[model samples]
Target chain A: MEKTLTLPSHITTEKLKDLYKQMWLIRYFDEKVDQFFAKGMIHGTTHLCVGQEASAAGAIAALQDKDKITSTHRGHGHCIAKGAETDRMMAELFGRETGYCKGKGGSMHIADLEKGNLGANGIVGGGIPLAVGAALTSKMKKEGYVVLCFFGDGASNEGSFHESLNLASVWDLPVVFVCENNQYGMSGPVKEMVNIENIAERAGSYGIPGKAVDGNDMVEIINTVYDAVENARSGNGPSLIEMKTYRWKGHSKSDAKKYRTREEEKEWREKDPIQRFKEVLIEEDILTEEQAKNLQEEAKQEIDDAVKFAENSPEPSTDTLLEDVYA
Target chain B: MREITYLEAVREAMSQEMRKNDDVFILGEDIGVYGGAFGVTRGMIEEFGPERIRNTPISEAAIAGGAVGAALTGMRPILELQFSDFITIAMDQIVNQAAKLRYMYGGKGSVPMVLRTPAGSGTGAAAQHSQSLEAWVAHIPGLKVVQPSTAYDAKGLLKAAIDDENPVIFYEHKLLYKTKGDVPEEQYSIPIGKADIKREGKDVTVVATSIMVHKALEAAEELEKEGIDVEVIDPRTLVPLDEETIVNSVKKTGRLIVVHEAVKRGGFGGEIASVIAESEAFDYLDSPIKRLGGLPIPIPYNPNLEKAAVPQVPDIIDAVKETVRFK
Candidate 1:
């Protein structure tokens, strides 16, 4: 494996190592969710964020405990990175009362406000503007916090994405628009869907700076997002940063992905973010191979526990449907 | 009290709310220096500056979605949609996120957000801009839909909506924007889900919303000349429907007519009828519940046809007459 990028020695290796572990945990949890789905142990659909872990972890690393985040459909990584309980997320997908949303929201709507994960959204381009609002709130409340919004390339084509960026720029909302451009938007390649060479370039229209980054390289993702987050917290308004990444799984389990060739899938697999991060940790001497293996095993065990908890949890009573549909 | 148009009243309500509360802010398209398309916010940018009276790009979803985020973070966001017909673009944010957020999270948080949009027909706004879709929002349980017929109710209800802890979809009739009424200078709030008795009669109860309420009042005057007394109940809020007021009126009059500017199919009027039919009031009825609303087709552009398609004074009179004659 190639040696991944790293910051100067002034930055703590421990921080980078911890980020690697968080990414690993999310990667493992996502794979477990996939397994549970295949075994019919989980209800609803799963949109795993496998190759896109670095972007989630990188942005989340810059956030304080009180900083907020809004996530899109492929949101497992974001939720996990933001500190949502794995067991609760699994229970939500299983439609259990013990779930984060009391079974009203499935895999696509896990949230933990205390942990600063505003929520996951089932709608494409749904959460972007909300995050901007959150950032605006932080600014208005004088909380000095920032909001990180994670959306896919498909959402970039949505009018909401453009609207949010422009509003954020105009109002100087404390928000960072992190576009996880994973090459394909449900089999429609980003290259074909948008004319711009990079999704970040579109931000220029709003008179805000935009940048593209190696989403698979954890250190690079962190460095870019950290700049944007700092700028936003300092009242510099919002910036759009597009992370060029990939998704190792289909859009959803029902998606056979007949539109693309296996060669394309195999090509993206070569740049798997999870594996790249691990190799970086090992090469930088931040973690030995043995420590990495133990961490992987530990992640696996935690995911197993989460699955067990979800399976044992009770389904929500029919009466609950009437209760939570309204506030 | 100062002389104000309906559009001017709405602007006053919003500007006053924003000025009074640090949390209250306005976000919409061309809402800043350009005012609004209808001139509702004509002078807000000059007073509040761009910070509070923010302008956004053309994304209805973003307007709503950002409002959702801001509301979640404790800033009471007042979002303005230029046209009600365009709400479909942000249906998920309005219905799924803003509406359901408070309840889904087990009441841990509330979406104290208000969406102000102009609805109903009569301006040559054509099919896309003139359709009255309040019933769609009222159908959702999490949403509290309010349509005030007069400037007094508009200001009072808009203030109440801003103070409300849940998501409220506040609708204004495009046709009603020019209509004005007496309003108090002192701060006051009208409760949501409460019906106002516009007129009292022993013969029949005319339950109406938005512009239809005025039509019902006008019809009541005409019906009085014919020796027929008509009671008018304005259901200012639709979702948390004022069932008691409606049922009591139906029981008293033994006849009921429900009216609205929206299309007949699944119009909020149906819900009131259903409540009356399913209640003990059904036995009190000397006649079946009559519903009068817009036709089940696109709102036409021609002034004559457009006015003909929706509920009017004549239609209200006809419906009240039909209900009174029913066995």
Candidate 2:
């Protein structure tokens, strides 16, 4: 934890506390989902972003409520950070009618448009261009809002990423491309996936500002994203911010993660974003140790209440399955 | 009523929509000052300016995905791909994002975007650029697919597509761009999923799409001289297909022929054939159903080969003759 860190002018102590709680909520929600999957209460596959919570929480905390975001498959953190209710998200994972997508979309497709989330995409690098489009709307309609596009290091190699960045730059669209470089894409390490030291270096190809940050540091993540978002809001065009982080879990429920060593996992766990943020909050006198513990318990209670709501939620009716296909 | 080229009709529709609605705008490669590859968006930039008529880099994925994002955030985006075949480069965005956003988001948000592309095999663009891939999008449940054969249908249907709440894949035939037909000057919209009975007769029903509609009508004229009356039906829209009109026409004619510019194998013709086969019209059929589409092989660059690739007017004539003479 950085003790001498200065918060952004717009970010209040209350907001920081809220962000810390959001990070915990994301952690507890995914951990419970992991338990549900292991117990066979949830079906299909889900990608968890346990150790990468700071990347989502910090970046989203920098955005306004009107600022939209396009998320990726491992998106629970992004959804929660964007102010989506855990009960609806949990019901969605449980395939209930009360879910975000009314049980239609599972873990990989939670969306809260009223909060400006454009939904989590199932395909790799799928949401990149969408962010550019949203920014185009902002510029064209004079909406004064920016779009924060999130993807992984693996997505940097996707043609969509290159194309979207080029489009956003050439058009000077109001968007910030946030690459959550979580070390590995599936089982392949970022080094093996691309021949680059930093994914942000590719932003130069599109003639845009690109920077890399310590993703585990919440203060750094928020500051970097806030700068990028302001640049876009002032009509300077898009910027690429690469947040170097790590996913504590496997790519999906079925991944054994044989590609990495136990030592590597232990190393990242030691740099836990939540614990680091909590320590920073306490050191800053924003909260006492007891208050920090209470926040963690509150997050656990929220997740437990979400699970109960999801369990009691009704299964989606077959009659309504055909609904919402159009319009 | 005024006679206009199909290309002009398309531009007129977009121009009218943009003029009436501030939220409506267009984006594509070479669409700003260059006025698009086919001049479909020519003069639009002058009226709407570069802010509204955006010229994007040659990035199909971003073009389509941007439209999805813009549409999701309360802007109506009319995205133009240089050629419909380039849609393959953007398939993931169109298929995964634009098509599924509304349904996957529990109908809380919608992608009111229209993806307009020039399709067909007449041009010397070869395999990469000359393809009628309407069936590819029509197969998706969350998308609305439309192919307009005449200037009237082109203008009206495009207006409807622009106003649509879901993603609409609007396929404009390359060969039909220069074709002239009567179009009303006032704003009008043709409802999607409604079949147009271009020509009425009692002998056989010719169900055609896009340029095939004109070929079917031409075939009907030739068949009329032979006393074999033909009913030409243009299914302007494919996904929310107007089964009632086709089924009723088949019942009256007792024969059916499905034609399209796409390949016969797994084409939308199969879907139309199934619709007729599963309906009460199957019992009234006096003969077996016939289907005519493009060759299985990729379209070639040579003019002769390109002409030979898809169903021409003569092909439709022969098919209608064969279908009428059946039994």
lDDT of candidate model 2 versus the reference: 0.90
Candidate 2 Cα misplacement greater than 4 A, ranges: A1-3
Chain A TM-scores of all predicted models: 0.94, 0.98
* Steric clash pairs (candidate 2): none
lDDT per prediction? 0.84, 0.90
Put down candidate 2 lDDT per residue, A183-216, tens digits, no spaces: 9999999989999899999999999999999999
- In model 1, the clashing pairs are A326-B142
Residue B173 in candidate 1 has what lDDT?
87
Predicted structure with the largest lDDT when compared to the true one: 2
Top model by DockQ, which number? 2
Error of 2 at A9 (Å): 2.6
TM-score of 1: 0.92
lDDT (0-100) at residue B64 of candidate 2?
86
